[model samples]
Target chain A: DAGVTQSPTHLIKTRGQHVTLRCSPISGHKSVSWYQQVLGQGPQFIFQYYEKEERGRGNFPDRFSARQFPNYSSELNVNALLLGDSALYLCASSLAPGQGAYNYGYTFGSGTRLTVV
Target chain B: DQQVKQNSPSLSVQEGRISILNCDYTNSMFDYFLWYKKYPAEGPTFLISISSIKDKNEDGRFTVFLNKSAKHLSLHIVPSQPGDSAVYFCAEGGATNKLIFGTGTLLAVQP
Candidate 1:
């Protein structure tokens, strides 16, 4: 089966602009999560959606938001982007939440590299 | 307040030698710990994970050891290969199922 896939592969935006990143989970997966990875740092959690509900959210600013569709795909939106928003946005998918997904580990997409100048 | 930290920015090991990467976390609520490997332009790949209840978990050449008391975890790769050279991140998962990740450690295996 194909793994998680992210769109645009890369993007360039200006400060105060808005951008949307998309992700398609693996087949049969119902949980999707988003993360941001700054240069030289590990990926940080942003939002997690299970079965189209917001299950978890990270410490990101209000400018960041995400939603999952019935089909299990997800979209991450950033409003009024800042230069610090420049990072790789990664989307991960799992079979379920909590223990059901813990053992299997999450499959991540190549990520969308967003650059805000 | 970084909850997770990988103090070592990078590590270099000779091929066939063992490579050990360490991680430390401050959150006691974390119940699951995982390791991920990432290439230059790709997303992190799930490596292996261990429950807080277990001290060690192994798969193929990769083994993860957790010290709950010390709030530390380590990933060991035996007979490291050149392909193993990449940035490795350790993460902690809690009730929310969201993972808090470390700063990452780059491992360069030389042939």
Candidate 2:
């Protein structure tokens, strides 16, 4: 089966602009999560959706939001982007949520690289 | 404050040698710990994970050891190959289901 797939492999935006990143989870997966990775740093959690409900959220600002569709696809939106928002946005998918999926580990997409100038 | 940290920014090892990468986490509540490998321009790939209840977990050439008292974890790759060269990240998962990650450590395996 195909793994998690993210759209618009790359993007360039300006400060104050808005951008949307998309992700399609693996077939039969119902949980999707988003993370941001700055250069030289590991990925930081942003949001997690399970069964189309918001299960958890990270410390990101209100400018960041995400939602999962019935099909388990997800979209991450950033409003009023800042230069600090420039990073790779990753999407991960798993069979379940929370500790239930810990053993198998979440499968991640290649990520969308966003640049805000 | 960084809940998870990888103090070593990089590590270099000769092929066929063992490569060890360390990680420290401040949150004892974290129930699950995971290791991920990332190549340039790609998202992190799930490597192996260990439950807080377990002290060690191994798969193929990769082995992870957890020290609950020290709040430390290490990933060991035996007979390291050049393909193993990449940035490795340690992440902690808890009730929140979100992963708290450490600053990555770049491992370069020389042939």
Candidate 3:
């Protein structure tokens, strides 16, 4: 089976500009979550959507937002990006939420590397 | 404070030896712990996980041991292979389903 897929493997954006990162979950997966990984650091959760409903959010600012489509794909939008926003954005897909949300662990995409100049 | 921490920035081990990566968390509320492996320029891939209720969980050459009393966990890879060289991250799943990750430890398995 195909794993989660993300688009624009690499991107360059100027500070203050906005960017949109996209993700397509594996077949039959209904939950999509986003994480931001800065250099020399671990990934930090951003948002999670299950069945098009917001399930969880992280400590990110309002500048970071995400939404899920009916097809279970997801988009992460970052507004007024700052230099600190430069990082790899990862997307993970799962079957659903609850006890078994990560029974097999999350299937992650290769991730989109965003560089803010 | 970092909820999850991997104090060792890097570790080197000989092939066929056992590789152990340690993680510690400050949050006792975390109910699930997981280990992920990542190659350069790639997202994390889940390796093994153990629930708070269990002390140990093993799969193939991978095993995860959790110590709730110390809020610590470790991932063990037996007979480590050079292909296992990568960064390993420890994560904790909270009640809200949020996964907090550790900074990561770069493991280098020598042939």
Predicted model with the maximum DockQ: 2
Per candidate, the number of residue pairs that clash is: 0, 0, 0
**Native contacts conserved, per model:** 0.82, 0.85, 0.73
lDDT of 1 by residue, B1-111 (tens): 549999999999999999999999988877899899999999898899998889999999999999989989999999899999999999888787888899999999999
C-alpha DockQ of every model: 0.82, 0.84, 0.75
For residues B13-46, could you state the per-residue lDDT of candidate 3 as single tens digits?
9999999999999987767888999999888988
Docking class of 3: medium
For the second chain, the TM-scores of the candidates in order are 0.97, 0.98, 0.96
Question: Which segments of model 2 are wrong by more than 4 Å?
Answer: none
lDDT of 1 by residue, A1-117 (tens): 789999999899999999999999999999999999999888888999999999988899999999999999999999999999999999998888664546777889999999999
Q: What is the lDDT of residue A14 in candidate 1?
A: 93
* lDDT score for residue B27 of model 3: 84
Q: In candidate 1 chain B, where is summed lDDT lowest over 10 consecutive residues? A: B91-100
Q: Please report, as a residue range, the 10-residue window in candidate 1 chain A with the lowest summed lDDT.
A: A96-105
**CA RMSD per model (angstroms):** 1.2, 1.2, 1.3
